[model samples]
Target: MPAEAGISGGSCPDFIFPPAETPASDGMTHPRNPLAAPVPLFYTCPMLTTLAIRDVVLIEALDLEFGPGLGTLTGETGAGKSILLDSLGLALGTRADSGLVRTGAAQAMVSAGFDLPADHPAFALLAENGFDADPGEALVIRRVVKADGGSRAFVNDQPASAATLRELGGMLVEIHGQHDDRGLINPRGHRALLDAFGRLDVAGVAAAHAAWRTAEDALEAARTDIENAARDREWLDHAVEELNRFGPEPGEEATLAAERADMQKGAKLADDLVAVGAHLDGSDGGLAALRQAARRLDRIAPEHPLLADALAALDRAVIEASEAEDKLAAAAEAMRFDPARLETVETRLFELRALARKHRVDPDALADLRDELAARLDRIEAGDAGLARLEAAARDARAAYLTLAEALSEARRAAAVRLDAAVATELAPLKLDAARFRTVVETLPESGWSPAGRDRVEFEIATNPGAPFAPLMKIASGGELSRFILALKVALAEQGSATTMIFDEIDRGVGGAVASAIGERLKRLASGAQLLVVTHSPQVAARGASHWLIAKSHDGLVTRTGVRPLGADERQEEIARMLSGAEITAEARAQAMRLLEAA
Candidate 1:
């Protein structure tokens, strides 16, 4: 068989162990099985296709290509296996240190290339960060660390920040180890994982929560308004009443001022008119004298032409004087003024101005102030009915939210039970038969509620019988912790998992069947996605569809670390070398063949 035959486009038959009976809600016995029934592999192309490292620690220059399925990396201690991971981490935007550069190199550079699906979340993230990313195009992230302790990051050759690279890295890869703090190890992500596993829909609950908050905000605002209005209730009533009795109109102040000025001027003009009237009224005035002169001149005008002209001039003077006296009589009639009416207008103007001063507003704005005060008084009187309606709305919203949250909580508890049972079946084959796994689903108080609902989920474990269960990190040994993480991953079947997963020394302490079990589970996980495992176990190495041997070599005065892909024969020889220390024996070779055949 070819060395990489099972690397892609293949499946392994499901291994059926003795069933561990779990009670179901239907009162029937169900088999708790960790190894799911065989399904076709979903991914044939690797997401991460290439990694290139330059002048990073002992790696002078290295470029590696990868394929889908399990790829094992094995080397002796201090043979630079960790260096490869560190180089990958640099490209993934981990914190950079100047010391990561080679001894005499000016800088270190690392690039990672990926063939992500068009619908991957990283594309959305890139767009949100102002980077133009097209679907169906290759993605490459590069990082350069300078010897002077400065670093720069790039995505597909475009300038990018390290923070962006970090976020993208989170979506692309998950690294699980004894000390890993992200992915399945973090409690903050536990609830989300559980929901994904159970395929629970949380949109309804989230929508209800938002509605409740909005209603509560409206109700609280109404209550505050009613309280403030009540505090000024008596003042509002008095102000409204005073302004209603003295109804002011817009432009009323300007009109009154104009009228008062006209009346004052009229009073002075009336006195002048009286003196002028005396001169135009009597029969001995200018009018009568001009008429008498014209009549005497008319009789003598017939005697000569000059006499006739003089007579015409006297007749015109008489007519002009009579018109003047008529106009005087009309003025005297129209300029008549009453002291009582003037007093009334002045009194009204004074009251309006005083009211404007009391309200600290312009005279014309007093009308608006009156309406506002009346509205306030109206609200204070009608507050109870309005408050009652708002209170009912808030109550209904709260009840709706509680209903959705309670249903979600119940679903989570049921999923937790199933997850615990699935995890239990994985424990025994990995040689933790005495240990027990538990998924805690606890309900938090209302204040702790979130859009996700009010349940807090955590995965806990106990290593021995009758022992108290604690968090996996706190209770399990380093080797046991790695195994526990593997068990959890196997049960989850990659639900909520990243596209590529890496395991560092997951098979550290165990040997024989336990090592074989770990290899089987890793191989099963790789059938659907891609995995890179850094391991020392020969069984784990034998299970890989592709093998890489990491080694340290020296030239003249410089030492470098290198990785070499193994062919069929070379893979057997390497596995034998891993089986027998320092030298490969015939028996070890035969045993390696058997392991490969079994895989």
Candidate 2:
């Protein structure tokens, strides 16, 4: 609901089809400014020539030339039109028909020459497939079928595969049939159709979807981090508390405790042992006897210094004995221990050691690791702000998408109005006055849109309004489907384009004015692009600016189909025969003239 950029607020880039100056297709919506139309082709290609073939289906040594305008192929049932189409398809790299080679020929060959502009899209394809070119020469593609059913392709003499041939072939031509409805009917292809239809809003929806993904990813990461960090907060707090209380400094308490414990256990025994040692040394009682002897020695040796030295030695010995007695008293006084303090130190050390064992780490690492865990917990607590930012981004993205989608919806509605009116006009002459055809414009939720917008526009019909609306493809019978396709092709003209459009028996089950209407539509379609139609009606056949008659022939053992470009008199004769059935009556000839004149 937020304010989004306005529709066409210089946002959607305008599409301008360039070769410039094809009129704004009258079939589609006409804005004040229209895109340029590409230049039309001037048929110069050597694409399949009815001119030459070898052992291919019912076609052999057949020669045919097509024009830039609509070309119709007409023949009696089973007379070989399908075979010609098959051969063309083969040269284009379609699957092989090993059994289709002429009755006795070793292989089949389908060759086509194309005359295209120097910058033609098809030319690029030919070159990409490794075909050589002579600057102005038209492209040549050929497929050869071996006797054993194997097939090979060549582009301008360079060996190529059937796949490469098919790819290039598809670009150059499109063959359509009632059952081959791939482009307009498939929902998977709808997005591209809308894009070509100039619906720019779908792009906005895609942008929004992308923004949503990115924002969602960021939000998820933040949530995970918060959960992990928060989960450890209680444990981290406990660890820091334990470390703080212990106050384990470097080795001081451990040294004091060790010394005290050793002294307490040994002090009493040591005191009694020291008293015994003093008695043995005669330090406490025979001191006077030793002193009197030392003095007599000093008198007798008055003339000898050795006697005097001996008296000094005795005095030194007495001083050392007194010093030893003082040391023993000190040792005895220092042996007392305090149980309360000892128990405290031992418990703290045990706690550190036990924690280390439980955690599989060294005791020294506990404090540093505690700080890291605490930091992680704090980070988790901070993720809420990031999640808020993501929510905001997703909102903005959706808003942007909706804004664009609305504008695209409006454009589609406008196109729908014009399209319905035009198709109705086309269908009226085809004997469907009661048929109500419409371009259904429904506004769907944003999820339905691509980059173009949230509008699902389906070409629908109420064979009668009381009946439920059904898509054109779903309800129309074969003949009706053909008519409907013509109406749409006429309504769209060439700007609403496809790479190829094929019509198989679109002319079946209709004649007179209805057939004429079909012909006009085909002509209109051709003006916009290429159209290949198969017809049994002379009216449809006569309308083609170019003509190919599919005929079957027997030469000895082979029954084959052949195609040829009809000369003017021959075209008239063919149309006459169509009007008069199996016989070419004069009346039918006159009618053919009138039809060609009106066309």
Candidate 3:
């Protein structure tokens, strides 16, 4: 026991389990072997691994720890604990509330510390960031929120995002409260509770959920695919028909466009050539008259130089007309009209424009339509096969999911029986004898994927005989829920309790023996987990391994709240005050002392 009490050989020697952190010999139940006499199992203090708060709503300076067994926090109603939790929640990946920033603060910082047990999953998270955390070393985190409205988080002083913090936080904590944003309030939380109680080992559960979700998503996508196919089936068929009719070659448009332009101007060019030829011919055209003039001039020019000049001018005119005729012929030959080619051009242009109007696309994009329309039609026609495949796949997936879910439900059912009994046993001392605790596992195959299961897992209760059994969530008053939660925690102790469990005056309505019972259960739970309770009940506080006093102080205008653990003598007096209201009576002090000794 002495050796077990010390830190493992890897950690610093002075950094031992805190003395007050150990379990007390209050003869608690042996969760492993309940039939045997109750045994007081020894436990070492849990390491303080990490803490952080940043510019998060109302947080000024955030400092805390990865604490162990029952580290209780106490303050007045609005002493900022809730805000602290909100900041932690946000840092862990809840939605970032820019409004959380203090009015005068610029940005908020949140951070956490983790002590990896050489194999904690958080180590992998750290490794992803390239930080090689030492084995057995505490993973320290710090976050600073700037007064100017910006924030930063660090793991071992290395930068990280709020998302990473959130991912890691999920594995680190499971906060339970009837009305909290966490826990059973969200239906999505149901799957997690089942998983936790089912004893699933990490990757297995995650993988199963991944596969299930993928299958579910595929089915949904297939439904949409089918709907869309039906919607466009008619349009797709029409488009494919039109595209096939045109049968336009891929590059036909460019070739036809060039040919059409040349043809449109061909007649004008030919007309010019004909006019020049006629003129060049005798009397009928320019060339013929020029030739006739040249002949007359030539006959006279045998002696006159002026006649020679007139013949040269007529020759120049004839040459010009001959050149124009050749130019027009060349133009006509380049156009080279084929009736079939012209008809093809007109047909293609008309088809392209008609398709363009039909599909609301540019003529140039007709080729694109041909491919698109054919593909769409093919898909619509093939949709029967696709939908069949999807539905088949969905059925298979749902079956697989149901198989596991049913198996889990069986485990839960068996566990629920024990759970109910265990809770009932705890309630015995709490004075709820006639009150029955029941776990009702309702499997609703019709209800779509809830985080919990196909089954609506609700805790049920019959507080009084003949009273209709109703869901624990709805039927139990706040006090009953607290007690129910406590009893559930007691049953789950062996599975491992949260590092810290805080019950704010959970012992409020009960007194005398019931207070003692609550204290006893807390003590029993504290054996494996830490229990922090804020209480006015002396019985409850008497069972605390350590006591803290939350008080207010004023230094000038600054009002500050502080917590300090009470000494043994101080504990005696405080318990007396709690027992006797405002005054500390000798009898009350004596009773407190006896309670302390009895504890």
Candidate 4:
């Protein structure tokens, strides 16, 4: 199917919403979820309240106040209408340069004030970014452009960057033109517009995408680990087995060396133990002699009291000798050594040292190295299982993402149905009744999937019957494109955040009834927000709720451009002038009167 030619009627076939299944009609009944809470009215829409421009291009000094409802700016071809828009653009954070300043002026200044509802999001954003804005009053944005092309920006009297000004401006106003860089024409904003229309929870889809990516990352990491570990698997296994066989224990080397030293010392002490043992228990030793003398004295002790006392002293000395001998015997027994056990311990200690040297580690650290190697081997053994688990998680995550994306796609299709019907209704009024607008949502290939979703969305159009539909940017003429943009703005107005909508000569080529239809639509579009149109059509000018006249004048020595709000009579005269060139006639005034009345 061609881009926009995929659908025939306003009904979207892929839409799964309740009321969206019905065919397109002039009027649509959007389905409300029963579980959804009733919407509470918060802030009234914001509008452009004041604009001041000085030394800007042809505009020397200009101040304009805007109220609610549809307003029109009427001027001759080169009467500085573009200056007004450019000044507003400057205030809205457009690039500032010397070209914008008047030829003789040193600098230029553009300031815009907006009357926004107290609950407007811009205030919160300002607070978040540390910009002071009094929510109770109007929001002000000011820009200064110097002759040297330097620029400065301020919001609510607080110094700010151009980006801040641009953000605030985006929420405050939307300017639509044939070649505007902002607004609904930009393809980047199409998805958001559709989601807003559908009232879909796009954040949910984003979260799902994030989850999917996380899972993908986890799986990839696991696979990479496996690949890396495979290269070292053989060495790791051999090292682990060797360490296990040696069975190195903490402090084993030091303990074994201390035992070996003790055994060597005991061997040297064995001779000394033998000599001491012989003296203690020898037959002719002092203890044996003492024992014999004590027995003789014991036998004669009854005959003499002195002899008895001497015998008792000898007996005490002999007892002391026997105790000494017993201690020597025990000491000798303790000195006994096992040579085979000592040799085994020495061999084991040497092996441990050799293994430590092989691994380039201290003997004390061998145990830790062994444990680390074991852990690595275990991980390699578990690699296949871990990879399988990660793969399962990735699959689950992808499923979750697909589910959310499919649901979001269904919601967008439903929204497209209502949007198409709404825009379709706007076509005849804008003199593009033969044209068709479509929100094309095509599923992308898996490789092309991103965080945004698995779909590509574009706004497409067909200008004439039987013509192949193409991208809106490629197919529509400049005038037709502007009208289409206007229709889309009207269709999405309720969902739009901007409080002010400006059209820079959207009514460029059309006249007669087509211009009248554009005026009527503009009036309808201005019901809740503010609308400002730069137009040459008398019919459109006559329908203005408020009118401003832009004209260039010569003040003797200088040329200047001035704009002022016109009264009822002035408005009538301006409209008459638009209808009858330089000469305003009675017939033209009558027609202007009729047009104003009809409007």
Predicted structure with the largest TM-score when compared to the true one: 1
lDDT tens per residue, model 4, 375-478:
65666688888878888999999999999889888777877776777688678878898988888888889997777777777788899998878876675476
Per-residue accuracy of model 2 over 65-108 as CA lDDT, tens digit each: 65555778887789977777777778877788787787678898
Show where candidate 2 strays beyond 4 Å.
Answer: 1-53, 91-97, 111-171, 190-382, 440-449, 455-457, 462-467
| Candidate topping lDDT | 1
On a 0 to 1 TM-score scale, where does candidate 3 land against the true structure? 0.52
Cα lDDT computed for each candidate against the true fold = 0.81, 0.64, 0.61, 0.80
TM-score of each: 0.70, 0.59, 0.52, 0.66
Q: How does model 1 fare in lDDT?
A: 0.81
Off by over 4 Å in 1: 1-46, 227-382
- Residues 1-599 of candidate 3 have per-residue lDDT tens digits of 12232233231222222111222223332121212122222223333355556455555555654344554444445555556556556555666656777656667766655544565556776788677667577766555556554556666667777677666665555444434434433344443443343343334334565677787798786667557756977876776787788775666667767777676556446666556556555457666666777887778886877778877877887787778767766766876566677777777777767767877977677778788767656656777787688778777876776666666666666545545555666677776777887667667764554434455666667888999877656655666667766766665442322244556566758899998998887776666554567676788888887777655566795544444677899888888887887678999999999999988
Candidate 3 — which residues are off by over 4 angstroms?
1-67, 73-116, 124-135, 143-151, 163-167, 174-179, 184-408, 431-436, 444-456, 460-478, 494-498
Q: lDDT (0-100) at residue 58 of candidate 3?
A: 50
- Going through the candidates in the order shown, the clash numbers are 0, 25, 27, 0
Native-referenced Cα lDDT, model 3: 0.61
If the candidates were sorted by their TM-score against the true structure, best first, what order would they fall in? 1, 4, 2, 3
